[model samples]
Target: MHLVPLIECAGKGFPDGFYEFKNCDSFKLLKEAREKQFVSYLNIGATWKPWHLYRSTLPFTPMSSPFHKLYGHLSDPVRIFTISGEFTGHRIPLSEDLLNARMVMEAKLHNLPEQVDRQYSSTSQSTASTTSLINIVDPETKDEVQFNDPDFRNGIVTCAALSLDGHHVALGFGSGVVELADIDHQHTISRFQLDPPNHPVWIEFVHGSHRVAAEDSEGNVTILSHDMTAANLGNLPSGPLPAVTRVSDNGLFIIRVPRNTDSSWYDSLTLVSILGDPHLQHLAPPSSNNFTPTSNPPILASEPSTSSSASIKSDAVLTIPHRRTLGFSPGAHYIGAFDGLSAFTWSTSSGELISSYRVTDFNLWIMNPAVPFTCSYRIPDPVSPRPTLSLTEGEAAHTHYSETHAGHNLDSSWIKCPFYVLLPSEEEWDELTMLDIHSSAAGRTPLFGTNGKRQRLPVSFNGKLEFIIPKEYEPVVFSGAKGLGAWYGDRVPFDPTFLYSPRSSKDGTRILLQGWQTAPIVVDLSQVI
Candidate 1:
């Protein structure tokens, strides 16, 4: 379907600074499965690899695409999978290094089957009043605990899981250690080691129970189920790598349980949604209506049914080739690998492919939502080197100087941000094409001096882009507003400005939104009458 750009939420002019989208008439919203209480998805951009800079580096040359050193020419044809989303709103940035940071966190936290508690401890110099702690709870006992470790003290916690009853929480780390925490009281329940020929790439908890699943770096999926004693669960090896086996080192691993409950075995299959090729379903059945019937149907005979030629095909296993990547969605729907794209949802009772959708390319890294603001601070610019003074001395002397210029338009509020960084792909360097999520949207705005350099489209919520920044903008200092930034889609040449969360008033008629100039913008998305 053609992508459509939206011009207005309901007509009245869009808030200033934030560009508006020109709605697309050709595209229709895919609402076949959408519901207010239905599936929620969290799209995340993958992390940046260390070599990405070198690969994108050019040799004394100015090229359109950055990675001329690595890709050579093969980069042109390949379309990289990008974008990650969750219920909590946020925007993924264009920086590659930040992307890697998010991915490492997600792989560590989401590789399990059950839901657990999570605690975030930031190391940023900012005070607690600014950067708040994030807590995850167990769905069962309602037990809550702090899951953050000393290692991730300052960094963000991207992925996490709690058991069906909230008995345990599997927390993933950038160091590749999957920490399984018990939520009864604050304590280290047990740490499952995935370090070996295959390191722990992802972790997850089984549905409705404490059964946890962890994927090794080799793409091997190992299920850990609890015994009746309510003790530490043992691992049940599903097999050496199913379709999701291709995601190895440099790949992402995530797990999810089924959320849709309209099936017969809704609780049985624990349908593990694998991100791969949505088109694969069509390839398997030739058509959704096509499936070969078993050679023989099961028969309930009165006289102790005797075995016969071509035994009743009561049990059946059908393998369909499709693409899958590691990801997560509402109701615990998870994609199990880090490679390819498209994720699948299947019927647990019949092992039949139920439905599918294209996963936003971000599964390689983080799965998060937007955060709130706190404070603001500024750093002085470095001094220029003089002829006689050493460069170090000049830098030190100038590092404390403050420069404040008006019209910089730096202050702005961002809302519903799912922060991420831009990193290089597994292959080689290629041009960065920031295609609009609303396909029909216009090309990215050129940054003037860059001569039409394209910016990747920022990930947004319901077509809105949000940025994170400080609550108060003071002078030229860098604001601590690292929350989510928002922008309007469907508008061409969208501004580089950020949008903030909509603040409601006591009367609820006028809504205050963060504006591009770091000021409050009032918008009315809903009908006042």
Candidate 2:
């Protein structure tokens, strides 16, 4: 319950980046909730309006960035990135000026159906590679379609992720195209194609290797390799946000629900193991005790479910190809700080970050076993400054401005991966055995120091952070930032609430509660984890 924000914040609960956060009754009420054990949360957004009635109607979204505390909106493409150890974030120019660009594109293409069809004619991966500048003159309407659109192409971001090192980001678009963006330089690096161009619902980067794992809505996965060798992961369980998985370190076995969906985006998980065999078992989320699979983990070189993060400034992007060429980019961008996620990390006694780990569902803890055996590629640096989100927009709404930075050790293949799928009890306050990555394993040698595998501890929290049930929703939720919509109790959700997600930092001390309507919130859970 000790809340130490990674950065400072203003009086109204807004972070330092926001221009002014002088007063907010809703934020105060949320603080009261934390003290009363009703809930614990801290608002991270600047108050859009100071009206007393805005609390209940604050806007929120479902889509968020991949590991860091960044959030995005499906309709409005603006995105923000929060510093580690807190929920307060500054707007990162992910889809910064997308609103204006979208408006322009709409004006240019809205009247020209033929031109629009020709331009977007084929969602096929074979279409001439897209770029920042689109210049096509239609003969029929004698109209021209030309502009500098970010790799996002103004499409809905189906999936995204930060590289292992935290210097880059890979974004999967509804256009069936994936783009690699640079965090340090602030530009897109390259683009990957998804065959049949279905909305890539899941995407990820294989740690220490050069591979991107991407899965479309129809469940088809493309293991995109920079070496031009791509593999098809076939189909996987398909659904909305966070239906993602990671590959094992060895190459075989996809561990679905490797870690229980620890955020609000998913409800009780049903463990379905595609063991790369004739027989597969479908198990439900365990009510009590850890649930182990009856069968050994299958080869993710074959297929795997989706899950994948990064806070480091050194992060890079993931990439791929279409058809039989093979590529991979698994994800659920889950849309929340944008909810920042905690990928496993290891540090030294002096508190210098030494090693970090990525997770895969394969039976064994291979930061991503499938990464080595299967084709992998380190997505190249962001190509150009084709703004997806314009700086103009990134600076709006009293948000903070952030300079893009990168970590120095992105190329390091260092890892401490655990390959177990321990189903957890969703009942709020229930205890679960979790690996304590913060407490390092000192025996590691060869420069790994304390940045190696550590012990597992039984941890618990003091809140009712359960999945939202629409049937239990109330029209008038509480006025506080943490209260259920005008209502109270563990079940707190409504139509707009599901659009967002949440994640923790590498050490798991600060948990980011992501939302779009208002700004994100940070909760200090160091006391629990």
Model 1 local distance difference test score: 0.25
The reply for model 1, stretches above 4 Å from the true place, is 1-169, 172-176, 181-189, 195-197, 208-211, 225-345, 354-459, 468-529
Error of 1 at 528 (Å): 23
lDDT of 1 by residue, 132-205 (tens): 23242221122111123322211232233434333344554334444554433434445444444233433545
- In the range 1-529, model 2's lDDT, one tens digit per residue, is 1211211122234445433432454344334322222111111112222221111111122223221212111112212342211212332234434335434444654444444455664554555533311354322223123212333234334445545444455666545767665544555566677788675655555432245666676767666756655667556555323343433222222223311123221122222212222112222221121322122122112111000110111221111100101111112100100011112221111111222223222111212211222211231121111122222331231122121111112112222121122232353114421221101111110000000011110112212221111111111111112211110011111111111112233233333322211112233333322
Instruction: Report the poorest 10 consecutive residues by lDDT, candidate 1.
Output: 443-452
Maximum-TM-score candidate: 2
Q: Which one is best on lDDT?
A: 2
**Model 1, C-alpha of 166: deviation from truth (Å):** 12
Structural RMSD, model 1: 30.0
TM-score of 2: 0.32
